[model samples]
Target: MPQFELANWLPQVAWLILTFGVMYLVVRAALPKVEAVKLSRAKVISDDLGHADTAKTNAQSVEAAFQAALVAARTTATKVTGDTKTTAAADAAARLKEIDAALAAKADAAQATLAKSQAKSLKSLEAVATDVTGDMVERLTGRRPAADAAASAVAQASA
Candidate 1:
């Protein structure tokens, strides 16, 4: 009997009123709270995502700074190496120049000594020649060469 009565239009009207009243009360009471919870969760997730993005940007900035420092260090090292090489080359050149100067001075001194020895040897040879010519003239005709003729003969022999 109750099932047959529920299927009738009068029972249908009663069910409609009950369902509408309950649904309106539930929506009025709970819908705002649910919406508020959803909006709060969305804001929290957005904030967390923003923090992650900021962290990523900060890491990239740190990497860029590290790379710049490395480049600076490499440039400084290269400059130092170039400077050292240039300094070494200059020092070597200076040492070579000093050595050349020393060698030139020694060569000049040796040349001067040789020239002095040659002059002394020439004087001795001239004296011996004069003595031999005087001895030959005395043996041949009993006369000696004059001083001027002896001087001229020594000059011609040197030439």
Candidate 2:
């Protein structure tokens, strides 16, 4: 019944207006700060995203550079290996040629020695054959053959 009373209406209206005005002032005062905070957070998040993008791009470029360096190293290694193989083959060929030359020289010397020994042996065999023939002729006919004749006969038989 106090709510319905005509004398309480103006006071109730005044209280409602006061309460609404205070609430409006409070909300109006806080709205800009809230909006500023929200804007600051949005800016920070954007900056962080930009930094992440830059880092990703840098990582990609670094990876590309590393791959390029690795490829270059491999190419250099292959070239060096090929060059080494060529050099080694050349060295081996040179050494083999030297050995062959030495062996040929040795063989030629051995051949010369063998020829000298054969000549000496032939001279000794001729002297021995001449002596045997003279002794055989002396025993068979009671007369010795001349040294020159026996030597000539042996030479003719050999020819």
Candidate 3:
């Protein structure tokens, strides 16, 4: 081939400049809008994540409040049961004391009645024994005791 000339090289250089200018315009002007759209999408994603965190915190607070209320209810139930037990024990004690007092009174009255019956039986038995002894003495000795002597002997024997 002959040596390259400026006339042929001019068209190639002009084509290169035109292609580069178009590429530069596309990159500088259109790429910024794409980048701005991407930045806006990233901001929306960050805001969503913040909202999710707030919702999780609210759920945890509700759970804690429910647990506290359950604990308080259990404590109140236990206290009521304890109070009922104490009242039942007090009632039982009062009944036992009343029964003991009644039994003691009955036993004292029975003892008083027994003592009075014993004294009356002893007096009757002494009179019967005196009459039998006097009859036997008169049959054996063929003599009767005087009234005053018999009275004195009966008194001494009874004592």
Candidate 4:
């Protein structure tokens, strides 16, 4: 009933108009700043995303270059390893050949010394056999065997 009273409506209408006008002016003054802040935030986010994309692309390119360098280094290392192995093998073969030749010479000298020692031992053995045979014959038959005959007897027994 109070809302519908026609006599109180003029003051209510004036108050409503004043409040609406103040609210409109306040909103109108602040709205452009709010919109500007929102647009600026969006632009900053877009710029950051663009920069991230560019950084990612640069990182990819750097990775690609690093991979290429690594491949090249590996190839070079393989080649160097192969070359070193080949050189070492060749050197080892040469040294082995030299050592074999030296060992063969030393073996030949050792064989020559062994042959001379054997010959000396054989001559001394023959002399000792002749003396022992002469003494044995003298003890058994009261006569000593001749040196040449004792030597021949020893040679026959040995054969």
Best by TM-score: 4
Model 4: per-residue lDDT, tens digit, 25-127? Answer: 9999999999999999999999999999999999999999999999999999999999999999999999999999999999999999999998899888888
Could you estimate the TM-score for every candidate? 0.60, 0.62, 0.55, 0.67
lDDT of 3 by residue, 6-116 (tens): 677888889989999999998999998999999999989988988998998999999999999899999999999999989999989888888888888888888888777
- Model 2 lDDT tens row, 29-105: 99999999999999999999999999999999999999999999999999999999999999999999999999999
Write down the RMSD of all candidates, one decimal each. Answer: 5.8, 4.7, 6.4, 4.1
Q: Kindly list the per-residue Cα lDDT of model 1 for residues 110-156, writing each as its tens digit.
A: 99998898888888878777777667767887888876677677778
Point out the higher-scoring one by TM-score: 2 or 3: 2
Indicate the worst ten consecutive residues by lDDT in candidate 2.
150-159
How much is the lDDT of residue 29 in candidate 1?
100
Error of 4 at 114 (Å): 0.4
lDDT of 3 at 73: 91
Stronger candidate by lDDT (1 vs 4): 4
Q: Report, for every candidate in turn, its global Cα lDDT versus the true structure.
A: 0.89, 0.94, 0.81, 0.94
The residue-level lDDT of candidate 3 at 55 comes to 93
